[model samples]
Target: MSIYFWGLVISIAVYLLVGNYAGRKVQGLDDYYVAGRKAPTLLIVGTLVASFLSTNAFLAETGFAYDGYAFLMLALVAVNTSGYVIGALFFGRFVRRSESLTIPEFFAKRFDSRAMQVLAGYTTVIGLTAYLLAVTQGGSILISDVVGIPYGVALVMVWLGYMVFTLYSGSRGVVLTDTIMFLLFTLVSIIALPYLLGEGGGWNATLTALASSEAKPGIIAWHGLTGEGALWSSGKDALIWALMLGASWSLVLAVSPWQTSRYLMARSEHVVVRSACIAGLVLAALYVVLLFGGAAVNLVNPNISPSERVMVWAGMNMMPAFIGTLLISGIMAAALSSCSTFLSLIGFSVSNDIIKSQQWTEHKSLRMSRYIMFAAALVSLILAYFQPPAVMWITYFAGTLFASSWGPVAFMSIWSRRISAPAAFVGMLAGFLINIGAKLLDNAGVLSLPVYLDPFILGFFSNVICILVISRFTQPTKAALAYFETIRQTPKEELDPAEVKKTLIWPVIVMISGLTIAGLLFVFYAMPYAAAVGREFSLFSGESLLSIGYGLSVFCVGLLAFWQVRRVYGRKTAQRATTR
Candidate 1:
């Protein structure tokens, strides 16, 4: 084999060995499912970062940058990071304290109904399956591009790699391997960004080239409905606003069910809390680098599309072979980490959440999970082989469906005392059906909703309305109220000695510091470029009191809202209530 191929093989083998070794202590379904609740903050953070930075981001986002500008990356980063902030400030604490094995488990506990479990399990599995296929296809493309392998062979290899880790170590292996992958990807992104930028030109020169180049690529322009490439446009400003609001809501909502299993596996609530903070920082940094890479691509070429192969093309064309190899490996790492997590998650839902509930023995249950994993992976592999090279909009549709169906159910199950079993059932079912219809319509290209009124937003409101309307007519059972009381009244575990040092102060400091740096970068680098290119941006210069006053007014209002939430919920108590 060539050196590049050898390096790829060696890297994959090393990660697999290291992961399995570190996760050897996972003893049973509990450990496999929840990692024995022993993960530290750093490990939790690493897995969270790796899980979120999946093959989709590498392929889809890069393709977007190639076609459009850095705006797509910037838009998504802002949206997702805002979701993290919302989660940490409101829902993260609650989720950590819930102590449930899966999102369905939480549903069963909070709603006092097995029907909710089965329903949620069904919705979660379906949404996750779509995401799984997306990851698998992306991985297949990467392997085929880098190693010159046939798509079928690459698909099988990817499936085998994921199955091995998921079957043996479960969530334990998922977290450990995810962490390693995150670190590797971070290094590669940093290395690749500079190499690409230096090759293209220094920042200023690159910006000039971009301005004078074909079609002014790299500017935050958009396609309205009457304009070019209008998928469904609100306006030039509509893209950012829709992306920031819609995408942020989806992230928070999806993370609740999607990552709830991993969060429940945390050693302690404090561990998960620290992990969330760290994950946010890593995500913010990763976004910045990706934005830079996207901008660098604009300096080289425009008219790029959002596809996995596009990223590989950019790396190979722009960077040295050695550097390109490393970046490809990093992208592969992202793909593998995401693939393994999906396999484990779907395996858990199918076996524990569905099949094993019919009374399989422990040995049988383990075997069942593995079998299910194998089956799911096989299906994903088949899909990958047949998938078109064009971008798939259904992946985001799946994400939207997940958010709409589970977000309200998750939020109410823990926080709202008024939510009855009927309410929960109606909320989940109504939201799910609406999202499904919208997704199908979108796929059929029949009726595209307005930018702000897409299926996710529609379904989210449907869920809210279902809960509110149902709750008014039907009173909550005393038992359901008692469950909410348990969540609210329970005292949190005291921090361990090691946790005392690692938990509260440093995490806060690090997160704040990271946000500050990201904000500064946005202001100094991102904002200036946007303003120069006829984008809508405002900044305060000396004696521009009007802008300063407006900024302060916005900040003050936000602070007041936060203060009210704190007063009513008692600092992270809203999250605790939601998780309950």
Candidate 2:
């Protein structure tokens, strides 16, 4: 067996050990559900990024970049990362305030409608189940190919690795293990980047080659390859596609059950905000390394067919055995972490929201939740066995479902006083149904929609329209209005002056981070690119603006965190409340 196989086995063994240790703390259902609602910023951020990134990122997204759209993917990033801050501030903190065990339950309580909760739960189960299958199949196939194992055996082995911890420890294990995996892939990306650059004759040579390649005209351009047989035929079409899907994915990060649910485990609203800012920073940085790294692979060999295999080709052929092993193991870890989260949510929802477990005993609830988790795993395993893998496409569909269906409703539930439960239900249903319907129709050649008119876009506008139109005819129930008002209020614990003071370091760290990004961009990226183009660097240059804008976004998000902490926890507000 290859060292890569053993590496994955060892990683899984370590995760299982640590997961079992974390399980010791799960003495009750809430611990299993929300890690006792005491997870700090690091753990929450870890799970958020881990769950969001899977094989889909390394394989599919990187492949897309290698196909000559690194800049476009980065274009998508500008819109996507913003959601972390937006969600943490407006939607996520309020979710913590709802104090609901699950996102669906929050919806149920917010609208005072059991049906809406069940409906929301069903969406979470179905969407996440498809996603789980994609990752599971993707992971198992990766292991089978690399380790020289049978695909069937690999499938079962990979499933058990994650299911074991998730079944027993739930959120506790997922968060802890996710943090470790996040570190692994992150380190691997950093290590692999310079190797790729050097192999292509460093930054200036590689960018110069990519920029001037006749065979790949416009490869690094803003619109990507706009020649014949390209995925996008024109710059206008490419930009439209970016703006459209960027907005859809932004919503996905904002209020998707998988993403926002992590906030439920946060120790406080402050944790929610801080973690989101840090996640935005980490995610953007990682994308630049991996996606740009993906494009850099072309400088070595541009003929790797099925472009998804580009990174894997680099791993096996370019890097050292150990780095290749780590890269493969890192991808496996991504799949496992995402599977753990999706399975936990699906099982937790089935047990808590759908079946309505007996809450009389903590032991009883834990046992019942585990049982449901096992059942969900079995169903997922069967599907994984039968289904063919389309790792990235499946990931894109399953993930974006929440953006259209739940995005508008989730924010509206919190921000819009005029929204009624009936409006919420219809809007949620319309978005899910319409989006799925459009996707199926388009896939089946029954509909002719452009890339910009993605099913999610159709669903999202329909959702908002339904809500706005229906809300005018119906009034929010008194219970719904009361719940909304309650969540809108800041939590009492957040007002502890000493508690707020301890976290004051976060704003400073964030501000310094912004300065660091700007400095690094000027020194590293902009200067190198200017030399490649045979021009002196200027702040007015495109590369400089990209770096400056990224730094400014980070700075502004941190500023929001600072101002929010002050407005909600300053001496005046603290004195108006009880204890400091």
lDDT tens digits, residue span 44-77, model 2 = 9899999999888888888888888887777677
Candidate 2 backbone clash number: 0
Question: Per-residue alpha-carbon lDDT of model 1 for 3-50, expressed as tens digits?
Answer: 457657876897689667856776677777777777887777777778
Q: Which parts of model 2 are misplaced by more than 4 Å?
A: 357-362, 501-548, 571-580
Q: After superposition, how far is residue 225 of candidate 1 from its true place, in Å?
A: 13
Q: After superposition, how far is residue 155 of candidate 2 from its true place, in Å?
A: 2.2
| Model 1: colliding residue pairs | 63-306, 94-575, 94-576, 414-580
TM-score of each candidate structure, all chains considered together:
0.86, 0.93
What are the runs in model 1 whose C-alpha is more than 4 Å off? 216-226, 230-237, 244-254, 301-307, 389-392, 490-492, 495-502, 506-515, 522-580
Model 2 global lDDT (CA atoms, 0 to 1): 0.84
